[model samples]
Target: MVGWLIDAIKKDYQPPISKVKVGKFNDYVQREYDFDKLEKKLLGWE
Candidate 1:
């Protein structure tokens, strides 16, 4: 399921910014929102 989602995203998603900026944004969001926790929740672990 997660692999399919990632594959779909890779097929259909396009970022408006550069890879560096995307990485920075991901880091910021992870730090700000505890994204690992969010992922666990999404995967029904919490």
Candidate 2:
């Protein structure tokens, strides 16, 4: 049963992001937010 499930997962797995797309996403996020401040606020540092 577990082996079957593992095989199914391995068959379905894919890289969620390609390298070129990864950089665009990072640039979009940084342009859209003050990420460091957002992180600190979410972490309760501020």
Candidate 3:
């Protein structure tokens, strides 16, 4: 397993965003995830 930031620095690479995205695919943009609605649906609540 390789570290993104470490590898980037080693290769002198720069990313579009300055945020450190770790342990997952870096495809997800920052967004508001409605966990409350998801939980309601999971519990079958209206």
The C-alpha TM-scores of every prediction are 0.31, 0.32, 0.34
Measured with C-alpha atoms, the lDDT of residue 16 in candidate 3 is: 78
Q: What value does the lDDT take at residue 3 in candidate 2?
A: 94
For TM-score, the strongest prediction is 3
What does candidate 3's lDDT look like per residue over 1-46, in tens digits?
Answer: 4698788889999657778657677667888879999899999995
RMSD of 3: 12.6
List the global CA lDDT of all models. Answer: 0.77, 0.79, 0.82
Best by lDDT: 3
Per-residue error (Å), model 3, residue 12: 25
Candidate 3 residue spans exceeding 4 A from truth: 1-31
Clash pairs, candidate 2, are: none
Tens-digit lDDT string for candidate 1 (1-46): 9998899788996657655533554554333688899999999999
User: Residue 20's C-alpha lDDT in candidate 3?
Assistant: 62
Q: Compared to the true structure, candidate 3 yields what TM-score?
A: 0.34
RMSD of each: 17.9, 10.9, 12.6
Off by over 4 Å in 1: 1-31
Better of 1 and 3 by TM-score: 3
